[model samples]
Target chain A: QQQVKQSPQSLIVQKGGIPIINCAYENTAFDYFPWYQQFPGKGPALLIAIRPDVSEKKEGRFTISFNKSAKQFSLHIMDSQPGDSATYFCAASRFNAGGTSYGKLTFGQGTILTVHP
Target chain B: EADIYQTPRYLVIGTGKKITLECSQTMGHDKMYWYQQDPGMELHLIHYSYGVNSTEKGDLSSESTVSRIRTEHFPLTLESARPSHTSQYLCASRGGNNEQFFGPGTRLTVL
Candidate 1:
């Protein structure tokens, strides 16, 4: 079972447009949700994150929207630029039985985004 | 950037050979994990270490083994390489609050 599900295996958007990627989870136990961005031949990097208590978080051109009741969340890239073209992954995790989450992430398959200038 | 490193970024070896992938972090994080991934797929956790001399298996059943002799280094070993083992392996370390630092990864090809 895919504990976390992400949509739009690939996305194409115009520069200056807003591109949104969505993700949903089956497990309500998950309390932390994070997004990662990966470039060619590089490891995934933390972009932004949010918790169940918060509905939205913004940092620069990136924002994360969370819906706890729906068990869903999304990443929104404002004023999308060519530099934002990369693979994005959504992940969720719960503090394991011992309350040690340790960032053992359960990730989505990933969404590849391409922005045209 | 997180100070995680992986050696031999790419490896190609014949079957029946023994291979070890090295991973290290200078960030002084106590939690480390190894994940196996195929092209364009979700990563599968294979092994992890909570600290020096502490190790555990992950959700995926893998034939590889890992060791954590020092807090700075974690390495994975495959006793005998097989074609099925060809894939990308990712190493990650976590500090407080479950934020992980990841390495560039090692791509292994077995023939």
Candidate 2:
């Protein structure tokens, strides 16, 4: 079973617009949620992350709105630009007390985002 | 940027050949993972290690084997490569935080 599900496999938006990518997870134990951005020929880079304790977290032009009750989270890009065109992935992980499963991320299906100039 | 490295950024091999993909990290992280990713698909965990001398299979069943002989190095070996094994392999390591840092993936192709 896919632990995490993401919608809109691909997205297209104009420069200066706002683009949103959403994700939902099945595991209630998941406590950490993070977003990654990947450009072609490069590895995914951590963009921003949030914990269930907070409703939202923002870093510069990127924001993550998280709803604990719904088990849903979304990434919002403000003033989307051509440079922001890349594949975005949402991932979730539970806090392992034993530290064995620590950092074991369950990733959602990625979304290819394109910001047109 | 994370100081992680993957060797042979691209590899093309014949079927039945034995191959090893190399992953190393300077961050000295205790957790390392191997993930397989295909175009337009989600990343699948194939193998992971908690620290030196410890390795475990991931959610996905894979024919490949991994070894963590050194804290900074983890290598994955395939006894026999198959066309079906063609995919991109990604290496990641995590520090004290929950986030994982990924290396440039190695694209493998088997003919």
Candidate 3:
């Protein structure tokens, strides 16, 4: 059972363009949402994370728009560059201060992003 | 920088052979997890440990076994490798604030 679903399994965009990746989750108990980036032969690294309390969060040119009511979230990369070409994944967890998730992350199908320079 | 490390970044073994994948962390995190990822696919948690002498199977069923005898060391072992077991194995540790850092995954290939 895939708790989280991501669309656009593969995306191609021009440099300096904005590319958006969308994800939808079914588990309402999920409190923490995070996006991770992975390069070839490397492990996934955390890019940004957002809590349900806020509707949006931004870091640098990356923004995460979260809609709690719809149980959907999207990642937007402004000024996409060739360096940003990698696999992206959206994950959710029943996170809490006490570690309700127990460090277990439920990941969605990954999206392979390509930035043409 | 994330201090988590996985040894034998790449491994190729014959079927029916025993292999061990090593993972170590210097951050002293109490929680550690292992995930299996196929090429261009989602990651699935295979195992995890909360602390020494405590290990648990994750949401995904796996034939690999894990042991956590030391806080910084968590190793996974496969008694008999199969072609189907070929995949990338990732190790991660969680800090006090729930920040999980992943190590470069080990790519295993069984023939």
Candidate 4:
């Protein structure tokens, strides 16, 4: 069913620029959205997350802008660095599904981002 | 550091061999999960557990079986390995809201 879908299978950006990645989901029951960053040969780590209640949330140079009605969210990385080159995954989950909402993540395929210096 | 470990990081075996991938977490979390991913593909959940002695199948139907005999340990076993079963398996744990911590993963190749 691919409840969540992400765009731009790959992205290329320069240092000190903003690289944006977008995602959209079909399941309205989903209440939480999280972004994960994965490097080569490593595990995916939580980058930032947002609840539907907020229009936007920012952590340092990373920001998540969410639009509930549109069922969409995007990640913005400011002053992107070469070290930031990696794969990004957007995931969604429902808090009340099957019992404890202990993070059964439905993920997007993934986006490969490249930051050139 | 919060430790979530997966052992046998890489394994290549002939078909029909029985194999088990081990996962353990030191953070004392009650929830655990197993996901399978192909190269450059989305992660698909294959199994999960809420606590010791509890387990459930996930969205993707898998030939793997799992057990939670202890709170920190969750091991996935394949009765008979096949070429179709080759994939990278990831283990994760979370306490709430699906904010999971993932292990490096076990990449298995079945010939």
Candidate 5:
């Protein structure tokens, strides 16, 4: 079973527009959520992250809006640029300090975002 | 940037060949993970380790085996390569903040 589900496998937006990618998880035990960005032929890089305690978190042009009750979270990119085109992934994990499962993340299906100039 | 490294960024092998993918990290993290990803699909965790001398299989059932003899090294090996094994393998290590840092993936092609 896929622990987390992401919508809109691909997205296209103009350079000044905003692109939103959403994800939902079935496990309530998930406490940490993070987003990653990947270019072609490269590994995914940490874009931003959020804890369930806060409703939202923003870093630069990237924002994460998390809804705990609904078990859903979305990433919004403000003032999208052509360089922002890449694959985005959402991941979730539960805290397991000193345990075997510690820091293991369950990833959602990736979203291919394309920004046009 | 995460100081993680993966060797042989790309590999192609014939059937029944034995192969090992190398992963190393200089971040001094206790947790390391191996994930498999196909084109346009989600990443599946195949193996993970919490610390030196500790290893565990992840949710996905894989034919690969992993060893974590040292805190900085985690290697995955396949006894026999098959065409079905063709995919990208990603290595990651998690620090105290619980955020994972990924290395440049190794793209494997088995014939």
Candidate 6:
């Protein structure tokens, strides 16, 4: 009954290498897709997000490629550094407007990424 | 960083003990959520609140209970903790733009 599925439970890459993590969802009601990055001892922080309206979003060295029709998305880190080593999660939620409904998220199985210096 | 905070970053208690995990947000947001995650695993929603006095169960079924007595404070209580309940609990708040901000999380271990 998992709604969102992510691949590559763990990954290792050398410094300056690009690492990509992929995810797919089964629910079409999902309107917003977001990626979260978590350090070893900290809470997850929003790295990047995209709406179904767009095909891709780029923030700094992070890029999110989204395919609405396919219900798939992937995260790409360009020229990754050792500091980029962490766990990444992809989440989806249906958008509700007018500030009445709570937008609960459905998260994917996190991917642990390690960048060797 | 979000203004969300969770108290007792790490807790270890005996089984059958009643415990409460505290969560608070200073961002004045109306929506708050609680998520449970395993070590290096995905996050599963346990509960969420839209505003004061409005609480709802999330997609994942959980044995814990949550209360939203105030807009800024949401506390989760486990009446009888068990070893199976050991996991990391994350508290989050949502702003107008629907972006969620997570707290540092509480890692609980029931022995």
Candidates, DockQ:
0.64, 0.75, 0.82, 0.71, 0.75, 0.86
Q: Proportion of native contacts found in each model?
A: 0.60, 0.74, 0.80, 0.74, 0.77, 0.86
Candidate 1 CAPRI-style tier:
medium
Comparison by lDDT, 3 against 4, better one: 3
lDDT of 4: 0.91
Tell me the tens digit of each residue's lDDT in model 6 across B4-105. 989999999999999999999999998999999998989988999988999988878999999998999999999999999999999999988779999999
On DockQ, the candidate that comes out on top is 6
Best by TM-score: 2
| Candidate 6 Cα outliers beyond 4 Å, as residue runs | A97-101
Off by over 4 Å in 1: A95-103
Q: Residue A91's C-alpha lDDT in candidate 3?
A: 92
- CA RMSD per model (angstroms): 1.6, 1.2, 1.4, 1.5, 1.3, 1.6
Candidate 3, A1-117: lDDT as tens digits: 438999889999999999999999998888889999999999899999999999999999999999999999999999999999999999988676345457578898999999999
TM of each candidate vs. truth:
0.95, 0.97, 0.97, 0.95, 0.97, 0.96
lDDT of 2 by residue, B1-111 (tens): 579999989999999999999999998898999999997578999999999999999989999999999999999999999999999999999878777999999999999
Q: How close is candidate 6 to the true structure, as a TM-score?
A: 0.96
Worst 10 residues of 2 chain B by lDDT: B93-102
For candidate 6, write residues A22-110 as lDDT tens digits: 99999887888999999987899999989999898999999999988888999999999999999999998877744434677789999
Enumerate residue pairs that collide in model 3: none
What's the C-alpha lDDT at position A9 in model 1? 93
**Candidate scoring better on TM-score of 1 and 6:** 6
lDDT of each: 0.90, 0.92, 0.92, 0.91, 0.92, 0.92
Tell me model 2's lDDT, rounded to 2 decimals. Answer: 0.92
Question: Alpha-carbon error at A1 in model 2, in Å?
Answer: 7.2
